[model samples]
Target: MTNRLEQTKALAGEARLAVLTWLAEPDRHFAHQETGKPSEIGVCVTLLTEKLSMAQPTVSRHLELLRRAGFVSVRKIGRWSFFRRNEDAIKDYKEWMNEHL
Candidate 1:
């Protein structure tokens, strides 16, 4: 019971919800690609910054929170960082919620 409450608190942040909503719209959240466009891949931090209209550090902090919560995954290539929704984690969360609450 205590552990379940802790899990709820951890995922209940406003910024984390906002980030999830943003990621829900991949085409709107990601940049245009030469070929596949938004479907090409994950969202860049800079793009997330612009979409959220928040400072880089603020976005970074929220992203870190989400990463810790297992709601998102971060990948780095060269100097750029990309973030994508962790669908499996989300599915697990839903299952837990259904089973427990």
Candidate 2:
């Protein structure tokens, strides 16, 4: 469908894929810090920067691209920003691939 094509086009960008690839391996890209509950847990921007060995602004730019592509979600807790995978979007993308690819 045209909608799927548009989404695919957005996701095909380089920065978007890098963010998704990082998210695909949470343990590697993020630190396992307890937040009392899993729902409140996500990869902190600082942790992500350290893992990627990149500047904060650069990481933020990449995150912005992924967010725009519907591949990730972000939440702010206090002064820190946390990012998590948008599983539903990913699942839908997989289903679309199965049907179209």
Candidate 3:
């Protein structure tokens, strides 16, 4: 149990935490561009990279971590990938933290 808790904490590192925060309010954090539309599915990776002020690859790595942690969901469109918050998973995580931490 302790190991699992520590692992979970480690997974939500600073960058991933920031990603989750921004993803919570996609409309405010990411802009809708002419090339892509922001919807319930998610915001584009390009917008995320710009908003995060990080390279596309770096942002993608962070997003991948968040996805593995079940904090975000992915939607692949054409050649691009969009991401959005997984509210249910986040809620469960919070509950687990409250109970365990």
Candidate 4:
């Protein structure tokens, strides 16, 4: 994992934040993916790319940053990668904010 400063930086972008928001309640924001449910296996990067209207590499880079930051987790199902929020890590960040800032 990267340092907390780097992790916080990963969460600072509008697009990345949007990604996190969409992932937080994916079923509400995104349609059911053919591979799996949004709440279960996770949301596909391809779906996120379409929704965000960005190139796949850009979206993937954001997801990779979040993964390194421990703000999200990934699962592999065949050739596709799925992503979901890491609620515990998010909670920890919130707690750190409340206590420090």
Candidate 5:
């Protein structure tokens, strides 16, 4: 139980939380691409980097953290990776936080 609480608190960091929030409304935060299209799976790393105004590697690290927390889902298309919010997981986390803390 304490371990779970620690894990939850780890994900509450500002950058990770911001990533989750942006993913909640993907279309609004990300622009559509000509080839892959943001709607197909989620937003591409390029768009996310642009939106966050951060470098690709930095955004990739942030996405990885969000993925570990189960707040984001990734789909690999060819060589490119796309990311979207895991709504169910986010909802479950919110409920658990409400109940536990």
Candidate 6:
């Protein structure tokens, strides 16, 4: 399991932070997706890349870190990689902050 410090590092930086914020309300932020419910299946990386205005590799790297940190969850539908925030883990983190920080 990843330590708290590692998860903290994953949440660092502007792009990654924006990613989490967008994922917090995928339906509102990424409402253009016509394939599936973003809240349930997650948003496509292509859409996220466009939203972030960053390279796919960069966004993918940020997502990978978040996935490892348990702040995000991913789903694969054929060739597309969909991503969404892990609300349970986020709530736990918030509660942890309230108690420890």
* Candidate 2 residue-wise lDDT, 1-101, digit = tens: 33566567768666657667777766665546454232446677777787677899988987876676677899888888878889888898888799977
Q: How accurate is candidate 3 locally (lDDT)?
A: 0.75
TM-score for candidate 6 = 0.93
lDDT, candidate 4, residue 83? Answer: 96
Candidate 1 structure quality by residue, lDDT tens digits, 42-96: 6788877887888999989888877877778887867877787888877878799
User: What's the TM for model 3?
Assistant: 0.81
Which one wins on TM-score? 4
* TM-score list, all predictions: 0.78, 0.71, 0.81, 0.94, 0.81, 0.93
Question: Residue by residue across 46-101, what tens digits does model 6's lDDT show?
Answer: 99999999999998998999998899999999999999888888887778779987
List where candidate 5 sits over 4 angstroms from the true fold: 1-10
Pick the lDDT winner: 6
**Which ranges of candidate 3 are over 4 A from the true structure?**
1-11, 35-37
Candidate 3: which pairs clash? none
List RMSD in Å for every model shown: 3.4, 3.3, 2.9, 1.3, 2.6, 1.1
Q: Over the stretch 1-101, how does candidate 5's per-residue lDDT look in tens digits?
A: 22455447648677777777777777676656654556557888777788778888998988887777777789988888889888887787778789977
What lDDT tens digits, residue by residue, belong to model 4 across residues 14-77?
Answer: 9999989998998887666887688988899999999999999999999999998899999998
Q: Name the runs in model 4 displaced over 4 angstroms.
A: none
Q: Which 10-residue span in candidate 3 carries the lowest summed lDDT?
A: 1-10
By lDDT, is 1 or 2 better?
Answer: 1
| Separate clash counts for every candidate | 0, 0, 0, 0, 0, 0
lDDT of each: 0.73, 0.72, 0.75, 0.89, 0.75, 0.89
Best-first order by lDDT: 6, 4, 5, 3, 1, 2
TM-score of candidate 2 on Cα atoms, chains taken together? 0.71
